[model samples]
Target: MIYDFILVGHGLAGGILARTLSEQGYKLAVFDTFKANSASRVAAGLINPLAGKRFAKSWLAEKLVPFAIAFYQQIEKEFNVKIWQPLPIFKFFSSVEEQNTWMGKSSNPAIQEFIKQVHLRLPFSESINQDFGAIEIAQSGYVDVNKFLDCLLVALAQSHLLIQEFFEFSRLNLNADFITYKQDNNTITARKIVFCEGFQAINNPYFSWLPFSLNKGEVLDIKVDNLPAECIYNKAVYVLPFGTDGFKVGATYNWREINEQPSAEALTELTERAGQILKKRFVVTKQAAGIRPAVKDRRPLMGWHPVHHQIGIFNGMGSKGVMMAPYLAHNFVANLQGAKLEPEADISRFLKYFTGI
Candidate 1:
């Protein structure tokens, strides 16, 4: 085979998989059709140890967090670029009722080590609506996703390992030894073809029955010249800085699954939420909507196709792609190398009845 693996998409999942395999000395090629509103592209790339208004500990944070930090660091060293920045998330408190609830749950031990209650002013207090001050989430930050991908893309191009095209299903041909694709008017062979098509994979004929519900997400890119330059601001709506004089403010979820364009209503709603969080209004520079590849059970989809020996999938990280990709990719690669399945994220759990295991 000319390549040991052919990876589709350069989103979090595909990037993680390709990099991991390449580190193990596997020959690889990545094909990606750039879309403006792709989830990872629009994402604030926020990672928090605890989640929700009630502040519950994130699922598998102890394991996932360390793995993510180390993995991104390794990639950064290789590319000679800095992408992951660990900034505190200042979660401001609103109503008195909400403050009471938070105070009561502060000692739950679920988030004890990660949460720090604060009455002092954070840097955002100067430009934010920090009514009752806030608790700083020590283990929260945002990833510079676009920049990370940019560095990776350049590196891949230099290595002659990337392609940019909408991978067509019609070109996929499976044989005993390799999976081949008629790409860029040339025939290419790979030991295995892994699909990271994101939300579009719901329509893939082979794996359509996996039960995925796509959610359209709308996010805003607003320029705020007077805001704090350090740490992400997470109140009702998260405000993440994306370098330069801009901040990425998002996001409203519309579970209806229409992803044609950014809805005016959604844009208005996002702006309204931002106004509530920020002390002053900012310019809405850009608005976009992308359908998240959300799965029914809300876990990532990884591992081999049920019947196709050389075909596979690595997707469904959903809104948590930035936080989940490295950990899940490690598991998937281990499984592909004939190691035992890790208990949590194996795709076989979902296909148990279908596979009769």
Candidate 2:
């Protein structure tokens, strides 16, 4: 049978894209091995509109946030599962000057949309230390990534649309009108194939030249007493409320050592940073690490190969996959249907890398 599309890697990008395309009435199949320590599984799935110390609005936050929320809600209704958790982000200020900086930006109309409230004094002084006050950000929350992906894979499996195995590049055969791959005793043919293999794309001979800047990030799950579970707390590091007394804290970035192995140094760093805001003692429950598929230019990578138009890529979402994938998937599907790809995200920007093409 000829499929409309074959997606490689069932991580966040591939999963969302496959679901998006399938809903649009496209015949498709997904190839993946459900590898452990993948970014999609390890990610906290944060959706924050304001980024950085200055609290500047994220690129295209106005559009991406609303679209993502609605998309996830639709997915929840379709799957009858709970994944999208809408919670506010309590961004604590470390200094008076930092608070002043936010006060200056809060008046801007664009920034005001994401700001819930500005607390001049410590809001939760008992469990938290807020000497310089904090800002409550609206339109922020987290997706239950593990639950979402697991549910997606199950739905795909039930429909016989998922091939649970490692994709072999050597077995792939691409043609002008279609592509074929040998799996076991049978061959699968599809009109187009998209590689969504996260950081592992660096090893892919076809799209490896796309300037991937991969980084390793580690996160920890801990049980803290008396910490507010009503919202996510952020200071040096973010302390995300989990179950009753549990909070997911993390994320230390390391570009030098890009592997999935959890290190002691990262554990210390995370605990110490989380300690700054979480004054209460906590017990470490779990630690995990994964590599982010980031790009040098800090934008998603999408578009067909310069020469092999039958081959395409939709990756490099970095840490913002939860907030960006659904909307990007919609746009990518639109591009496949004849619309122009978003210029910044279009791989055409790096056409120079495809030297011999």
Whole-model Cα lDDT per candidate?
0.79, 0.89
Q: Which stretches of candidate 1 lie over 4 Å from their true place?
A: 118-126, 183-185, 352-357
Give the per-residue lDDT of model 2 (tens digit) for 284-335.
9999999999999989999988889899999999988988888889999999
Candidate 2 residue spans exceeding 4 A from truth: none
For candidate 1, write residues 1-357 as lDDT tens digits. 489899888887887787777767888889987776788888888888877656677778777877898887887887788888888887877866667777777777767777766544434456888776777788667788888878777777876577877778899888888888886668888889888888888877766767777888888888987787687777768888877789988778788756758898998888888888888669998887888998877777887777886878889888888888888788778777688655556666767535321
What shift in Å separates residue 260 of candidate 1 from its native position after superposition? 3.7
Residue-level lDDT for 117 in candidate 2 = 90
For model 1 the local lDDT of residue 120 reads 40
Error of 1 at 79 (Å): 2.4
Which residue pairs show backbone clashes in model 1?
A: none
Candidate 2 vs. true structure, TM-score: 0.97
lDDT of 2 at 69: 97
Task: Judging by TM-score against the true structure, name the best candidate.
Answer: 2
Q: Candidate 1: TM-score?
A: 0.91
TM-score of every model? 0.91, 0.97
